[model samples]
Target: MNDWISHFTSLTAAPDNEKALFNKARPVQWGSDQIIFHAGTPCNQYLLVLEGQIRVQQISAGGREIVLYRIGPGESCILTTACLFSHRPYPAMGITETAVKAISLPKSVFDQLIGQSGLFREFVFNAYGNRLTDLLTLVEEVVFTRLDIRLARKLLDLGKHAQIIQITHQTLATELGSAREVISRALKEFALRGWIRRGSGQIEIIQRQGLQQLANSEFVSSR
Candidate 1:
């Protein structure tokens, strides 16, 4: 109960309702890389992540993949909630990025809380709005911005923890919604300029400032 309360502000405000939610929720676990839900699958349960990350991505008919968003500890999925309310199958896929511990709420209990608790209602709407805005931003970037800039920014993000990023070209392509050849060409240009060192399934950032400049400007003409 303490863990649930701490993770959700809605639960924290309504201590009395916490017990009801706890009674209804079933704890679930998923291993790394496991599929939590697939595209076209019916949405039956609402998930509250207690720990680890769940990546929500979309795959096209041509087999190209693009990451939409991620759900982490203390967060819920807006897409899941929307599907439940609209009674539609999921249009995107959700997979566990790491081993996860979460709580799955039945539809009945979810509706009950939405109707009975103001705090919970606010939490749900706010989460939905925020996630919706993020998805919209992704769409704008994909449509209007240069792929090279997006890829550079993504590399800088992954390189924050360490200089070396252990990811393949194809994975990076998927992350930025580009093809493998496009990613390879971008990486080749970066390497030629001594901005990074690339190896099998890995890239080492050599010039942080250079990558930062590229991410910040439209200076690098899109190839």
Candidate 2:
């Protein structure tokens, strides 16, 4: 097995630490769309994703949701780390967006490694700091940015790897923390302008430049 720790370039390799991690880290997998953790659930293991994506999100009692962040290859969850360290249940939920492969380190092993391994400690804190920054940015966007600009940007980002994005407006609203009707109205404006075409549960980009222009300028009005 490849020293999975190698995926994280920030973690300097030590033979002893690598050996210990290898012995204790259990490989795990989850199918796409699986719920990995829920709010108020105690975290039993610290996860380091080796492949695929796990989306961390917060869902409200009335079924509204806002995506917090995604944990992808070479990354770990800050929420999981916080839970492990603080002995607290998860504040939000983690669900697999795709088939996921990861290493699960038991809480006891994680505690010991965080104490003894400088590289491990550094890696943990750095990941935490980076995710914290991302969350802060998300907060800023949700608070002050216009929804149309965010929607354009989000569509561009989601369409990067695929020509057609498979998502519903309701899901997109959940992503942007807005009502479905608001997202539909924005999307209608984009469609009327010949930028995109929306179908059942799918969105196809008709003109990338149009979206690029909208996503880049905060001053550009729909008029």
Candidate 3:
């Protein structure tokens, strides 16, 4: 119950009563690269990530997996709202990037909590609002930012990890909505510039500051 309360607090303000109602929620584990849920599957529960990262990807009309976003600990999956309000199936596929621990609440329990608890309702609203903003930001980035700049920014964002960034060219292509050859070319360009060094299974950032500068630079006459 205490753990459940903590998880709820991280997501939104849950009153003591609402938290108590969720005390019986069970925790589920997901192995690395496991599929938590699939697109178009019937969404019966709300998933709250307690640990690890999950990738939300959508298949485009061209049959390519487009990375929607990554959700880490303390984030709720998209099915939270869809299961409650929509008749159409789950919208996106959720794949675990690492071993994951999450709590799944039955749709009926979630609806009961929402109906009986104002705090719970507010939490859901805030969570969805934040997710909406994130989606919009990603949309804007895709529409306005150049592919090279986006790749640089993504590399910089992943640089915070001490371990080598373990992503293949194909995976990078899917995440960036580009072709594998394009990602390979971009990596090659970065390597020639001495900003990054690629290895068999990972990419190491040799000049993180330069990468940051490239990520933050404006459209200008000089690089």
Error of 2 at 215 (Å): 1.7
Q: Is candidate 1 or candidate 2 better by TM-score?
A: 1
Q: Write the per-residue lDDT of candidate 3 for residues 22-115, one digit (tens) a residue.
A: 8757788989999877867887777778889999888777767778878887778655475667756767788898999988778788878879
lDDT of 1 by residue, 2-82 (tens): 456578766676766546675788889999999989988999888999999999999999999999999999899998999
What do the candidate models score in CA lDDT, each in turn?
Answer: 0.88, 0.89, 0.78
Clash pairs, candidate 3, are none
Give lDDT tens digits, candidate 2, residues 1-223.
5477677777646566555665788889999999999999999898999999999999888878899999999999999999998999999989999999998989998888887888788889999999999999999888877788899999999999887999999999989988899899999999999999999999999999999988897653333
Q: TM-scores for all candidates?
A: 0.93, 0.88, 0.84
Checking candidate 1 for backbone clashes, the offending pairs are none
Q: Which regions in candidate 3 have their CA more than 4 angstroms from the true location?
A: 1-3, 10-20, 161-164, 220-223
Give the 10-residue window scoring lowest on summed lDDT in candidate 1: 214-223
The TM-score of candidate 2 is 0.88
Which ten contiguous residues of candidate 3 have the minimum total lDDT? 214-223
List candidate 1 segments past 4 Å from native. Answer: 1-3, 15-18, 219-223
After superposing candidate 2 on the true structure, give the runs of residues whose Cα lies further than 4 Å from its correct spot.
9-12, 15-18, 161-163, 219-223
Score residue 121 of candidate 1 by CA lDDT.
82
lDDT of 3: 0.78
